[model samples]
Target: MVSAWVVTKVAYVVISIAAGLIFFYVTSPLVKSEKKQPLEESVSLLINFVLYIWVGKILLNIDVFITDPLAILAYPSDSDAFYAATLLLFGNVIYKVKWKGLNIGTIMSSLAPVFLGSAFVYEFIEVVMNDSTLAWGHLGLLFLLLLFFLIFHERQSSVATAGGIFTAWSLGQLILTFYLPYTTLYGYMMTRWFLVLVFILSMTNLIQNKRLRS
Candidate 1:
């Protein structure tokens, strides 16, 4: 039997994801046909990523799982689990790109709008429903990112736009970490070093895309 708290968390996740898909469909520059494959791929990858996170959580709390497997469902995932899941997701992406001929840029492009929309809605709910003032700064940052992406996404290649959005988001969050008590991604605490690494990787992608074009 799932507790009300767990139910509420699941509801929030569902709402955010639905909002994101709707937002992407409404705002994306791509035509219906062009959008189809990327959208499908993004959703598939996201489901796998969530599964990875759940597996990470279970592994992190193996003792609790051994003692009471059902109780593990109620345990909140921590930053370490999130980080580990992220690494696994990255590995998955690399494997797909290498062996399956998946286009990393196309995947990132589709993911950008959905991520922004979901994050904004989630933070907005935190601020309004939960009365969390700390979420306001994140909300502001997401809004700016959405606006920036909207302005330039149509003008640039998908890879450049995705890279730019990610770079800006990482840099913005890195800056926010200094002012806010802590910065978070989907309620999990984000470390500064991780943000720095993301920033570097995003920039590298952006530069590589530019060079390829040149």
Candidate 2:
């Protein structure tokens, strides 16, 4: 008999794949017509981010991991894994931006909508699995906010638009998390703070770039 937890885990993978497919479908035109390389790189980064989390999970639970290494892949992931992945993602992005001469803002902006789509899908699935009204409501409001920004700020530079949306999403998530009864999830808290930091740094970069242009 498969445990409910196992069922939920399988459901999550299905939902995640569906979300990725939807994202790819929506971005198909852009990939074919414009900035194909940048889009591909952005997607590669996302893939790396997930890989980091899975690898981190296994590393964190090495004791059990060694006994049944594949078990780590089967069980529900931990917040620590998220934190580890976030750190690795940030490090990799910085390296690419500085050492590899990548345009961080443009790449991030190109991927912003895709990121939002995936987030919405994942959160929707989470709400269904957990039956949490707060989660559902938060995701609903978040979707609206992202859409509003993407539309209203469409004329802005990619960096500015992406930064604005990213900042808004992170801040909104912070507020929503506060309303939750249990807020002691360190990994979640760390992830939110890291996002806030990224937003700040991105804005600063934009400002500096603008000044240089001027």
Candidate 3:
């Protein structure tokens, strides 16, 4: 029998494809835009519609950690610190804003799933940050997401806004890897995927509403 982890991961791939088809169906306006874009750019826009589903999940997971205070006190090391550092990294990369004050805010924001989800693996979930496969998967997902965002927007201002948001998010993931244990990390991840599912459903609903209106 497949473990829950294997089952969820497999389910995620199927859900992502479904999300993609729905995105394409709803944003058919973009089909015209695709022809006007560079071939690589067009491919990226399509892929990113699917990726947004995943990113929404990450933000949800961040919320999970924030709601739990004891987890922060108990696992006081680097997870929050790493998020703080990554926020700084993002600030420096995108906005050139480098106030020391924001690290706390970043830490608070990254804490959602760690505090809320009680599930634990053989070890702390954040510990998986040290795992090569996990780290690489996050990095790959982040890179593609950012790339897709950059290509999605029509204007420089929109791209800049996207860059800032993407940087902060990627930084949050970096924090999770360096500080939190395996269990916290797993919770964070699960939270994100759940959020992704919700977001896709919401988007689908909006499309149905518009079709009814027309």
Candidate 4:
């Protein structure tokens, strides 16, 4: 039998895979566009910005370094803020995306509720069950992280990035919710890895799509 922790981790991994593929398919159209900037450059810009989001949050969370709330929020917010950035990328920058795939649609559809709902449910569990020892602000931070995805970059990659961001933030939310004894940074690590992976997938899809189109 799979433990709840294992189950949650597996679900996140599955979400990551789904998000990566969906974004790849959705961004296919933009990848082949007649744009002046190199496709890699465009994707690289997105990736770099996304990386900047977490660099502070990750470092400050270290046991060796104590951080202010604003500083703490910076990383968490960046992780959540990434979704909003994706919206701008897809909406303002990229003009096209193949939104025909069922996988993409399904992934996009399930993402919002999953992350947001997890926030509420986490609180509910903390209140209802006696197992929770986490502080309210910590839990509240999770809520903020989960809801941070309100408006995303909204480009061809939005479908995948939205889901991917949601997944990553959701994992962060889940980990932060738990009353862990030590090493609270695992959630952040997991979130960063997923975001990086999804970004890479988006870029790869663009390159492949561009090549095939040419």
By lDDT, the better pick of 1 and 3 is 1
- Ranked by lDDT, top first: 1, 2, 4, 3
lDDT of 1 by residue, 1-214 (tens): 3567667766777788778877788888888988889889878887887888889989998998989988887766679988989999999999999999998988888888889999899889888889988999999999999998888888889689889989999999999999999988878899999999999999999999999999
The TM-score measured for candidate 1 stands at: 0.95
Per-residue lDDT tens digits for candidate 3, residues 46-163, read 3442344334334435565568743433342233343433344434423422453332222221221111111122122223533544444444444444455435434423323333
lDDT of 4 at 97: 34
Task: Compute the lDDT of residue 186 as modeled in candidate 3.
Answer: 28
Q: CA lDDT, every prediction?
A: 0.88, 0.65, 0.36, 0.42
Backbone clash tally (model 2):
0
Query: In candidate 1, where is summed lDDT lowest over 10 consecutive residues?
Result: 1-10
Top candidate (TM-score)? 1
Looking at candidate 1, what is the lDDT of residue 66? 89
Q: Where does candidate 1 clash, by residue pair? A: none
Model 3 poorest 10 in a row by lDDT: 109-118
Query: Which candidate should be chosen as best, given lDDT against the real structure?
Result: 1
| TM-score to native of every candidate shown | 0.95, 0.77, 0.26, 0.30
| Model 3, position 73: C-alpha lDDT score | 33
Cα lDDT over the full model 2: 0.65
TM-score rank order: 1, 2, 4, 3
How do the residues 1-214 of candidate 2 rate in per-residue lDDT, one tens digit apiece?
2356756655665565457445644644344656567567767887788788888898899999999976777776667887788788889988988999988765676666666666677667767767756566457755786666547554666666666666666666566666665222211333556656766875676677567657
